[model samples]
Target chain A: MLIRKPNPIRSSEITSKDNYLNRREFIRAGAASGAIAGASLSAPAALAAVIPDEPLAKLADIRKPSPFSTDETLTSYDDVTTYNNFYEFGTGKDDPHRNARDFEPQPWSIKVDGHAENTGTFHLEDFVKPHTLEERIYRMRCVEAWSMVIPWVGIPLADVLKALKPTSKAKFVAFETLYDPKRMPGQRRRVLDWPYREGLTIAEAMHPLTILAVGLYGEVLPNQNGAPLRLVVPWKYGFKGIKSIVRIRFMSRMPQTSWNLSAPHEYGFYANVNPEVDHPRWSQARERRIGSGLFAAKQPTLMFNGYAEEVASLYDGLDLRRNY
Target chain B: MNINTRIRYVLKPLVFVLALLPAAFVVTDLFEITGRLGANPVEEILDRFGNWGLRFMMLALAVTPLRRVTGLAWIARFRRMIGLFAFFYIAMHFAVWLVLDQGLYLPGIGEDIAKRPFITIGMLALVLLTAMALTSTAGMRRRLGKRWNQLHTSAYAVGILGVWHYWWQVKADILEPLIYAVILSALLGHRLWHRRARSQGVTPRLRANQGAG
Candidate 1:
């Protein structure tokens, strides 16, 4: 007889409905405590002090241990939140954590347009309310040859797109991050044009593996991790996972992506995890898993980040080397 | 004590301590004494050493201009130490990439140096730095004579390559690398200006600085 061990993180750790409702109160309390923290430490440290201590609004009714989930050791919640590539906040891995402390992802809305029947702005809550949330533990491969396994809580993009009623002409889906420089300090610099944009083919967008994540590790998404909503394409490089989404448009043509626009030769439209196709300066053959200690050797990178079985057919005849 | 004695005792040790701080900080961070290296400690360590190496190279190059401007010949005494520290930090950076990052994967290391332009340039700089470091002693300086000065002129080439290596590695937002490029340009331009001035017999003061340059 096999003995099944209980998982460390479960529904018991999820926030109660009352705690979820009192999120604003918690934020207000956080702000007050942040002010007190400011007196002792420097400005950035003060902001950082408030974040790890405060309880995030934990997501409810998350269906975990899904068939789609990976059985990998989860990256610590602190590492997941702190080390990020949300260029909207800043370019440095730690910059987002430090700078996005005061970012208000609350009262957010997303605008749906172009080749879709649902063509108006809707509150983020309304967009999320319809579907059953799932916990997808995926291997997130960065273009910089770093990897992480994150437990994301989100609804399938296919389910959300079905409600939007995309037309036959909708061959691609383009997503845009919020462009407010006041909140997103990095937006002021024109790093890769003001509003960072990413796109996916209609087929890739509708894949069950693709999700629009609203939370991570059973908690509401932190500001640094793209609060409210963000795209999560498990098979693609992390840059394809656009953060802090404000506008999502269905289009006839392949949409322009920010990194591709920045350097067309280096970054391409189809940013799949292909170990064979090397970046201009670095090898994509291997990735250093984050939180794997200092001396660990980089593991060999997998095709489509080990989701080739699920996503390879989407690009049946396409040359990933050329597309990448 | 006389000024030379004071310089030898007080200034040299102070400069040594100041130069060693970056390495000290890395060791402390590696041990997580202050817990400041963030999530990826190896990357932080690697980047910090590389950044300081470039900074020290800049400092080594700046010594001539500083001595020329300030007329403080004692500053020249620190140049050798500074140049050696630059080598030390750069060697640390390369060691980290080889041992910790690549895990002594010889084939991968060779591929990166041969294929990648940035790594190729960085490797060239390291080779030049190694040659210079080998011949840095006073005995080697006397034995090589005129060839010593000729070989050391490659320092400028190393400076340019270091900056270029940094510029190529950056994904986007070239602000930091751009700043390094600008400083290198200034240092190179200063040398060109002084050399031109010395050739034309423009100023006696300028000609006096040629020995150090």
Candidate 2:
């Protein structure tokens, strides 16, 4: 039951393979020469002019425009795929795009562990077979004071968690990204503790809004965008949406996350997008919308990235300032 | 052409254009005239300017040491132009942060300068560079006399602060900043050795063309 919606515009129609591939080769050659001016200027510029509009691998039977989808302007496919902070690929903003070109996302499988009844490794297709994929246009706000509106295609995490039949002892859900240094070159350097990890309280994990995204913009997830599978929690900061997940565990207690482990003072576990709690290095009150023109003014960061109405009650009594 | 004429007419202008190339690239990227910027163009523009500013400042500092070591007194002639370019790039960095990134938000700017250590150090470096740039003229140099040397000595301080600012601002991967630190250390370290040798009245071979300034 592999569900896939036919794409109206084929990728080849938008930009021929030879056209973009030659450009990529030229940029790669420019980059290897250590010419910073040529690499930085020409690479992104060439990408802008001829960004491929075709979806890589169309997901089957995606329900269009979910009730949870936002009506906001979508960040272009170019920006969404080209600009990423996937440190597993590299730390530079464009490093993921440049470095992750060779990563293979197929033949993927997930290991389910902890107190869950289905405590074994399952094929990716099997895991996704039971759920109906839905489109959720989420507002992704990064802790670095930038944002993107992404239309993700995935199934609800709640339905998946319910099917797994977590035991009463399961109070938290822990996730781990694939940790193959051969595949993920950035892991070779100790960027933020390898095999990037993230977790959520059982309640938050089971929230209706929480989704495990497999694709974006109705296409197969690009490797840089965490291909195969990634988490999408609209209410939280973008870092919380861990990418390229390989493990899901039912934890009895709070599980350690990568960023919180890296710099506890800067990134809290519950990385809800609260404008008031400023990052020590920069203000969190405003965020520049990615793909917005150079002169576009930064928009005021919203509470819970504008999902406070849906999720504020999750932390009714807790002080976010202290927790943050 | 004579070496002096070539340097003044051809080489100096070449260096000026070379220095301006980074800014030109940024301008084109900002307008998407050539290549487009990354997802966040402001961040890209800010970083390009800051990186170039740091580079020019490094070049400014290197002029004296290079001239001393290579016995090239002509190198000193380009120091002012390089230093001014450093100031220009850094000012543009500050301008982008103020206008495009911060959107002319006074409170945010004020808080960043006051609260963030990196921003604070960066601002201090800019202020020092500004003072040096203002007094860089020949007339001001004559008027300030010996005091001019004292004021320009803050260039070393600016170098240190510039590196420190970059070091602190990075999220992770301090490799780039660490390289700057090592380069700055070597430049300043050469100066320290030269001073020590001068005081001992035993000039090293590398100090052959010293006192060009």
Candidate 3:
């Protein structure tokens, strides 16, 4: 139901040539011309006021918010969050967003702890607002075996980590999602071990590819997709990139994540998207692009999602199969 | 005699046709989801088919309670056929997922279930259904006897698993799966309660000293 609304920001920003009104128009023009697609999001910041909120809203927003943005990026909450990654909400590619409206995002604060110099209870908005939204086109591969190209608006994880610098011994990063039985009814049942937990190697956490994204397409993150904030690691299986984050922990040892602990043989911490390492029941040779038909052609799964130039060094010399 | 024979004749075909419905819906929906149906339309189709599978499985589990309440003993006759159809559509769901969607590749399917918990539970439900179907024949039922009953009891487990698999897969919306869960749980609960009462129905009395007399 929520997925049908046209993006609010797109509706407002695409109204006209109002230079002082918004920056989105300029960004759109820039991206259209292939000039500066990944640069600023709107028309040079000079054209927003003149453009009324007609075609788009000021902010747009979903599953796995990208850390990058361009005119091609989605810029509305309806498009962004309503299209999400929460598994309990349902498993259709877009089901989470459609079903996640009731999840109240306010009264939200994440517990920040574990091997950190700066430790305290942080309100979700306080953490989310400080960062400028940059749109990065990311390759999202769900463990459920589908893929999508998402343009997200978020700050680097490095930046977030910098603020809450971990102690020297912090060798891994772990996050927990909200586990309330009332809101997250799925947690009430034992499908997984209640609240979801996911972790990453320290180097993977520090990689430029890792992001603590706030918005996607162009709006604030939607509830189904882990509203307000979630992690984006383009190199790992989607599960390694957890959702609905409520806690951030830095530890010396690898965190025993929900999936890994649930079934160790199947889900390893180094769940890099490797085609060579076969899961017990199925192979990871290829992925079905989400928009494609069920019988649509399959695309070969790339190591580190073809981001090896960016992330392979993180696992240098380590056998991904064993780690996986 | 006429009444009894007529009831059997009608019930025989009804079970067969009711059993085919799940398979029919899944196959038709797979085609719809695969064809150029719009995104929302395809999503609706996939979702509805899944619902039907769940509903039919619940319906099959409803047999005992339904038979007790309505005194329609013939309803019990349909349970196996309905169960097999439940497994059949579940197989279709797997095929759509592995063959058509994932191209029958193992890694993609694993990654999917591994990455997505919903897929994991969904696959588990399918696995349970498959096991139940494999042991569904009269031969296996007789060979295993009590174990067969214990094994087929997994139908309840599979049905619950199906509800959860469907429920968790949704991201934001949840009303539909929740409703299905309630109905299945109620039906299963009735069977459980009934069985518990039946097992305690008669306590053995001590044979008094009347043996000598």
DockQ of each: 0.65, 0.53, 0.17
- Judged by DockQ, which candidate is best? 1
lDDT of 1 by residue, A1-324 (tens): 222224312432566733543464456456556555665475343333211223367676678788999999999998998998887788899999889999888777677878998655566755775677899999999999999999998999999999999999999999988888899998888677757789999999999999999888888888899887899999999999999898888999998788888888999999999999999999999999999998899999999999999999999999887889
Residue-level lDDT tens digits of model 2 in A60-141 = 5688778788999999999999998999999998988889888988777677778988565556765675677898999999
Query: How close is every model to the real structure, measured as TM-score?
Result: 0.89, 0.88, 0.60
Which candidate has the highest TM-score of all?
1
The models' CA-based lDDT, in order, is: 0.86, 0.85, 0.66
Q: Chain B TM-score of model 3, please?
A: 0.79
Q: Between which residue pairs do clashes occur in model 2?
A: A3-A60, A3-A61, A4-A59, A4-A60, A4-A61, A45-B35, A45-B36
Q: Relative to the unseen true structure, what is the C-alpha lDDT of residue B73 in candidate 1, on a scale of 0 to 100? A: 71
TM-score of chain A of each: 0.83, 0.83, 0.74
For candidate 1, the per-residue lDDT at A108 reads 77
Minimum summed lDDT over a 10-residue window in model 2 chain A is located at A46-55
Q: Per-residue lDDT tens digits of candidate 1, residues B124-171?
A: 999999999999998998898889888888999999999999999998
